[model samples]
Target: MVGGGFAGLWAVRALKSAPVRITLVDRGNHHLFQPLLYQVATAGLSAPDIAAPLRQILRRQKNVVVRMATVSTIDADAKTLELDCDGGNETLAFDYLLLATGATHAYFGNERWAAHAPGLKTLDDALDLRRKLLLAFERAESETDPDARDAWLSFGIIGGGPTGVELAGTLAEIARHTLQGEFRNIDPSRARVRLIEAGPRVLASFPEDLSEKARKQLERLGVEVSTGTPVKDITADGYRLGETFVPAKTIVWAAGVSASPLGECLGVPLDKAGRVPVEPDLTVPGHPDIFVAGDLATLKQANGKPVPGVAPAAKQMGKHVAKAIRARLKGVGIAPFRYRDFGNLATIGRMAAVVDLGAWKFSGIVAWWFWLLAHLFFLIGFRNRSVVLLNWSVAYWTHQRAARIILGGDDTRC
Candidate 1:
């Protein structure tokens, strides 16, 4: 198993009672709850609240061994993997290989923009962003020049996806409510928060009406939502919003993502996004012993639409691959994999969200509550759920975020 994410972890857990021995390898030591990652980036929750150590999680299972290393090379014909660790490089042999390696941010050919606008994908990214955000306010408070101070107070989020929406909404709340009356020279409520999307509407994957509702909800939170506005260039000073250059100190890139380059190592033709077009059974073409799941694999449903890369789909794919492996050991053929659409949910701001469950669709405070509960239920471990629930409760009632401390040594110069 390659990756400690939802796909790899679920696959490992599902194979606990099986006859085969397993080795789970990943570079990161902890399994992160990515859906709530934005909360950590926005100071709503701490890092540990959404992450669990891998060894601790798999301690009870005796059939599995966890290795902390990066898989550098995969020789499919020899069924050997080259692992790079702190000590040295080593080759490990495997009977069956599962590549659940996840994805990273895509700059869409403007790699230099990454230095100015960072994307939130991991714990480090979140912490760095939190520091940048808090320091932006602090820098603004101490600035002497009016235009420089305004630029320091300005913030821009470049994507309209779930992460972008959640970040923009929470940042607005922090400026207006959390940091209220904290600084004498500047009113934090006057900070400018902008959400820019090149597309025609936000949450393009959702129903049209829900997208409209989400836009309105963001606007109500004082977020300047700009749609159909493509970003031409991004620099330390600001970004080019279509034809005009907007000055902003902090910029977040949540626009696009590409699959891990490990897919190319498999020697298979990949899609435009660098994702492997897997077989119906979630196996790589011409290599039944090799499986790919999560954001790394791409599969089209009967309806001709690609399967969404949400947590549910990744978990299901992981379990399906595990089932296939078990059947293969018994010389029994399993049926083709089928994805069950479980609907979608996106939160805009406080007491605002949109839910689409096929025939049933809803938005507003009720949807927000539903979103909260659903995330709590899906979070791993009792302690995590408890801590997150408590933090959220405190923030909801007090309108103040709990984990607002900026620790990293990030550049906050205006």
Candidate 2:
């Protein structure tokens, strides 16, 4: 198995009962609960709360061997993978190939923007953002000039998707509540959070009404939502949306996403987004034994829409791949992969969220609780769920985020 995101992890988990021995290779040592990554960025939870050691998660399963390495090359003809394993290059052979390397945030032709605005995909990105955001407030507190202080207090978030919306809401809460009365010179409640989206509305994936509702919820929390505004440029100062220049010290890019470049090394035709084209059974074209799942594989559904790059879809792909592998071992053909639409949820602010479950759509406190329960149920480890619940419960009641410490970053500067 190549890669260790949700697709790879779930694939390995399902194959434990199969007759095959598994080797799960990944660069990281933990399986991160990606859905709750925004909480880690906003200081609502710690990193460990949303991540579990891979070794511990698979300790009971004796059939799985976890390797920490980066796959450098894939020779399809030889069915061998070259990896930078154990501080040296090693060639690992596999009978069947499963590529679940996943994807990274797309800068949309502006790769340099990554330095100015980091996207939240991994734990390191979250920590870097957390440090920048918290340091913004600290820097603002120490600034002598009002203009510079205001610039330090300002934040710009590019993208109005779930990740962007959640970030804007939580940052607003931190400014309006978490940091209130904490600084003498600066009123944290006055901090400005601007969410800029190139689209016509926020949460474009949801219904129009829910999108408007989410917009209102964000506005209620003091986040300035600017829709149909495309970012022209980004620098250390801030971003430019069309003709307007917005000054901000912190910026987050949650806009576009592209598949991992590992798909390129496979010597196969890929889509514009760098995703490997897959067959109905989630296998690469002309390579039945070589399966690709999750965000790395692009598969169009029967409805003519592409499979959404959510956690559920990735897990479904993983399970389907596992089934196909097991069927091959038993000399039976597996059916084509089918994705079940399980609805979508995006939190707005305190006790506010929007949920779209086909026709049974809802928003507000009920949706917020629903979102909480669903995430808790989907979290990988028991300890993670427990700690996250405890942290959220305390934050909900006290309006105080417990994980607000800024550690291991450059000192606060204006």
> Top lDDT: which candidate number?
1
Query: Per-prediction TM-score, please?
Result: 0.99, 0.98
Global lDDT for candidate 2?
A: 0.92
Per-residue lDDT tens digits for candidate 2, residues 1-414, read 887888998999999889898999999999998989999999999999999988999998888999999999998888899999777999999989899988999998999999999999999999989999999998998989998899999999999999999999999999998888889999999999999899999999999999999999999999999998799999999889898888888899999999999999888999999999899999888877899999999999999999999999999999999999999999999789999999999998899999999978999999999999999999988888899899999999889997888888447433
Estimate candidate 1's alpha-carbon lDDT, on a 0 to 1 scale: 0.94
Task: List the lowest-lDDT window of 10 residues for candidate 2.
Answer: 405-414
Which regions of candidate 2 deviate over 4 angstroms?
412-414
| CA displacement after TM-score superposition, residue 238 of candidate 1 (Å) | 0.4
lDDT of each: 0.94, 0.92
Pairs clashing within candidate 1: none
What is residue 178's positional error in candidate 2, in angstroms? Answer: 0.6
